[model samples]
Target: MRLRNHEGTPVDPVPFLVVVGLTFMFVLSFGPLYGQALGAGLELSVGVSFALFLAVAFGSYYWQVWTARPETVGVVPASVRAVRLFYLMLVLAVLMIGLAIPLML
Candidate 1:
């Protein structure tokens, strides 16, 4: 389903979904993997990962909402910012996963 802002403008969900998915994966799997690589136990790793995920996800949401506010004016629109954040998150996630894989094996 499509999301709408306060102005009733349709917002693209792709970037949001991508960010969520990548961040989810980072929490559920990548965090633990990285923890293991660092010789940490599963429980501790997962806990830390979950906390980090929440922080990142909430921060992203906050940024999006803040940018979309009527008082906010910028050269870039909220949708464009969302897309840029998505790309940045995607690349970072991929790189982290890539780095984690070697440590895992």
Candidate 2:
């Protein structure tokens, strides 16, 4: 499907792709994956990992919105908005689980 901003503005495909790419990469590189990789006295708690994930996601969202402006200043389809939120929340939940699993062990 398509992606939209919290403001219900439809995001262009290119910027959306870029945002997803960067967000996923950041999450993979510096989120729980990095923490787990430390594998010693450097283990991070789930709270810290989730917090970092939120920060990275927030920053990525804003940066993308700024980079892909103009048409993003308007409204989008309700279905599109709903889908975007659902997808984002699902991703966040998965990230939390992934982070927590590492710490649980």
Candidate 3:
């Protein structure tokens, strides 16, 4: 499957994956805690990892658009803005839930 940028442009997966891959690698390198959790018992860790990866990817896409499309600022339709805000909140909630699950476990 291919990844789309915030503006629905088909982003080059090579560059996007490079950014996300390095981020995931950096995360796993922090300590053995994640590894132990994954190996020993906590299956939620996998979900958390995937959720984080998605969050980072979307965030990066938005950041790219924000920087590259300065002229499009203030031209967004209200409905589109609302939809974006809803998705942003939903993703944030998912991120929080993912983190909370690890702590709860």
Top TM-score model: 1
Residue 95 of model 2 has an lDDT of 76
lDDT of 3 at 84: 86
Model 3 Cα lDDT, one tens digit per residue, 1-105: 565555665545554566677557644432235645557434555556666777887776566532344445479899998998799769866865675577457
TM-score for each prediction? Answer: 0.59, 0.41, 0.38
In model 1, residue pairs whose N, Cα or C atoms come closer than 3 Å (at least 3 residues apart or on different chains), thus clashing, are none
lDDT score for candidate 3 against the true structure: 0.60
Candidate 3: regions farther than 4 A off = 1-15, 28-32, 35-40, 65-105
lDDT of 2 by residue, 13-100 (tens): 5755565665665565556555556662334634466566677666766776535555644578788988998998799779767756
Total clashing residue pairs per candidate? 0, 0, 0
Model 1 lDDT on a 0 to 1 scale: 0.73
For model 3, which pairs clash? Answer: none
- 10 residues in a row with least lDDT, candidate 3: 26-35
Ranking by lDDT: 1, 2, 3
